[model samples]
Target: MTESAFINITELTREFKNKTALEQITLSIQEGELFGLVGPDGAGKTTLLRILAGLLQITAGQVVAAGYDLNKEPEEIKPHIGYMAQEFSLYEKLSVVENLMFFADLYNVDVKEQEDRIQKLLSFAGLTEFKNRRAAHLSGGMQKKLALATTLLHEPPLLLLDEPTTGVDPISRREFWNILTDLHLNGTTIIVSTPYMDEADRCSRVGLMYQGELVICDSPVNIRNLLDGDLVKITTSDWQEAHTVLAPLAGVKEIQTYGEALHILVDSGKTRLPQLTRALKEHNLAVDEARTASPRMEEAFISLIRKMDQVN
Candidate 1:
């Protein structure tokens, strides 16, 4: 491992049969850094996390994590990291506190200190009141919190979470992030893969994966600036027709639709706003709303993936 890198990967790759899952994934995450992995479906996010957690084999390359070579000492690295899978199992028969005690015992927590630790974790995960509630009886959000609390039983220095917030409600997701923020503040390095762009924006840095490759990795602001053009958001009753007209017009380079609003990338928002409006009017389309808008993470992510598709 590098002197300061908590998790160091060099030219890592994973293969299943003939399909390449991860290709030359080289990354070094420093201590206390909150790294977010973002990409479309089947982008190798889970593959990379599984390799780091010692749950999957790397077909090629090197990984040094927690001061151990993953290839040679997979078991040695396990105690240094807390890995939570998307479908991490919780005994549906056990209550929240029972589940915590089970993992604490498994981790070999000191008999005398286990009670104190479990209590604190229950409070931390906001499950103190639900201590007696069975895992299966808990809501999707609460169950996720319980799973997270279980992973922290050993108080590992690093956390590898794979879509911990999927299927969770918005409020619960926010609360989950709050717990993560607390962990990050206390100097625990976290590498989380999420599809939500807003979640990616919360990380100190983000790595975008695509087609079994780490396509881009940088700060959220830097990634958004990757698209060197302005964005214009427009809403029209005739969005289908408007799309057909605006897609081929001058200055428009890319377009995406979100519900009834259309987001268009152009050479310059100031120059294209009037040009686009005029073109829409010429086609007799009613522009419900149109304005120059700030570029967002989703736009940047899609723009990067689109460029990658073109290259391939």
Candidate 2:
């Protein structure tokens, strides 16, 4: 392992009774890096995080987290990592503070420091007012925050979060990312798997998994640049017809629908924009708006997935 690598994996593979969950997966994460993992369902994001947390055994390869070899010392690596699974793993009957206290005990937090740590975490997670609320009664967002707080009780330098904000309200999702940003700024290494592209854009670096393989790992900007085409967003009524008319047009690569908008990917927006507009007019489609726009993380991800699909 390199001196700067906080977590290192090589040819890491995990298998089940009759299927492979992860294969030939190799990744390196540096300390204090906010890494985002995005992928389709069954893409092995959760499996990889679980393996790093020492919750699952690897079927092959090597993993070294925080200098502890997972193959040889999975238990020793646990204290240096805080892992939050996708589901709400806390006790529903327990109050927020009680859950924190319970996790504090499990993590063997210092008795003298528990009070200060718990109080600070409550404030940090915006749960000070609802600290006494039972876990089951808290909103989905609040429950996720509480789960994060519990994971932090041990002051682990590395955090592994699997879809922590899934099914959460927009406001809560933003708040959760805010806390993660603060943690990143304060030198915590966080590896989070998220289904949201906006959240993936906020990461220092992103790893895209597909069919159990680490397909691409790079900065958000670089990933977006990999779209291989320009994006042209066309807003119009009867988008179904507009899509059909433009989909087979020259230079058109792909089209993604968003309500009344058709985000069209083409070889060249400059050359294809007017061509597409004219075709829509010929078809008598009422074009409300048509313009070239920046390709976002979502477009890049979808493009990559499509390419992979074609290959497979």
Would you estimate the TM-scores of all the predictions? 0.97, 0.96
Which residue runs does candidate 2 get wrong by more than 4 Å?
A: 1-3
Q: After superposition on all CA atoms, what RMSD does each candidate show versus the true structure?
A: 1.2, 1.4
lDDT of 1 at 46: 94
Task: Indicate the residue-level lDDT of 205 in model 1.
Answer: 98
Q: Each candidate's lDDT (Cα)?
A: 0.93, 0.95
Model 1: CA > 4 A from native? 1-3
Number of the top-ranking candidate, with TM-score as the measure:
1
* Tens-digit lDDT track of model 1 for 1-312: 467688889999999997999999999989899999999889999999999999999899999987889999988888878889978489999999999999898888889999999999999999999999999999999999999998998999999999999999999999999999999999999999999999999999999999899999999999999988999999998888999999999889999999899999999999999999999999899898999999999998888888888988
lDDT of 2 by residue, 256-299 (tens): 98888999999999999999999999999989999999999998
